[model samples]
Target: MNNVKSLNKWANAHTYLPVDLLRMALGVFLFMKGVYFFSNIQYLVDLLTPIDKIDRIGAGMFLIHYIAPAHLIGGILIFFGLLTRWAIISQLPILICAIIINFMGQMHHQNLLLAILTLAVCIFFLIYGSGKNSADYFFKMQK
Candidate 1:
């Protein structure tokens, strides 16, 4: 589409080293979180309990299965800046649920702050797209 091409053009023009570093850091953080969740699924269960309560269709189980893989794979894709927008879009729902669970279940300042920060960064990347330092750009240039 015209809008996507324009956005991509803008992102390519505005690439910065610090932003790439931040994006990589976010990728590592999410990957670690995914690993943590995979090892300690009970935490996810506890977090998603409120969702289960709100809906009786065993949605929590589905979410429990969905989150770890999404984070792991999405994190890697984000780190490489390959399909960055799609990766970010996949992460958006998980981050939203993370923010929502804080209030619905137990309120923890650390978690609340982290969720907000991650969500904000995800939104930024969603709008900004991947930059020149990314695999996406490298491959695009190859074309």
Candidate 2:
């Protein structure tokens, strides 16, 4: 699509080291969150219990299954800057739901802040794409 091309061009022209570091940090943070969630399944279940109450379709169960794996894979893709936008796209819904759950679920201050921060970083990368130091740029150059 024209929009994707334009976005790529814009991102390519604006690559910076700070942005790249931020991207890597975001990736590591996400990966760690995934590991934490996977290891502490009961913690996640307890957090989502309230949302499950609102929806009788057992969507929370599905989310419990989906979130950890998505974060793990998406985090790796993002760290390597491979298919950057798509990786971010996969994470968008999860991040949005995280923010919402923080409000409607356990209401933990630290969790809410972290979710907000991660969501903000994700939105930035969704728009910025991977930078010149990324696998995306390397592959683009190969082509």
Candidate 3:
């Protein structure tokens, strides 16, 4: 009876969180795409049409060029469970911009869907702010 009770308690304490999964998924997605972006500079440069028209090509390059860092840096932060909340917060705008760009010029349903899903994951990360097992455990601010 005691063992059964303990098993039940352990299960209750270890329920899987959808949000943590979302964060990890986003991290993986970003990391993979970042590698692709860095490998093919021209491809990313073409995507900067919106920013280019506004006389911000340099700025655009700086932002887009750093997508890999988001994946690399953000992934590390999230993976190590350190400063995850801030990392997610930092990534939100980048995901939003990608979504907006995908919607702005050509109405490619696939691109739109991808952007939307990415944005949704960003939102999920914000809400969950990393789970207990994450390195976020150390820097967790008291609310």
Best by TM-score: 1
For each candidate, give its TM-score against the true structure.
0.94, 0.92, 0.73
lDDT of 3: 0.66
**Models ranked on TM-score:** 1, 2, 3
Q: For candidate 2, lDDT tens digit of each residue in 1-143?
A: 89978988998888889999999988888888889999999988877776756357767778888889888988898898988889888898988887888887668898788888888899989888898889999988998
Model with the higher TM-score, candidate 1 or 3: 1
Please report the candidate that would top lDDT against the real structure: 1
Model 2: weakest 10-residue lDDT segment is 49-58
lDDT of each: 0.88, 0.86, 0.66
Question: For candidate 1, what's the RMSD?
Answer: 1.3
Least lDDT summed over 10 consecutive residues: which range in candidate 1?
Answer: 50-59
Models sorted by lDDT, best on top = 1, 2, 3
- In angstroms, the error of model 1 at 3 is 1.3
Q: In candidate 2, which residue pairs clash?
A: none
Q: Give per-residue CA lDDT, model 3, range 45-89, as digits (tens).
A: 777565546444357657765666786677667655567667777
Candidate 1 pairs with clashing backbones: none
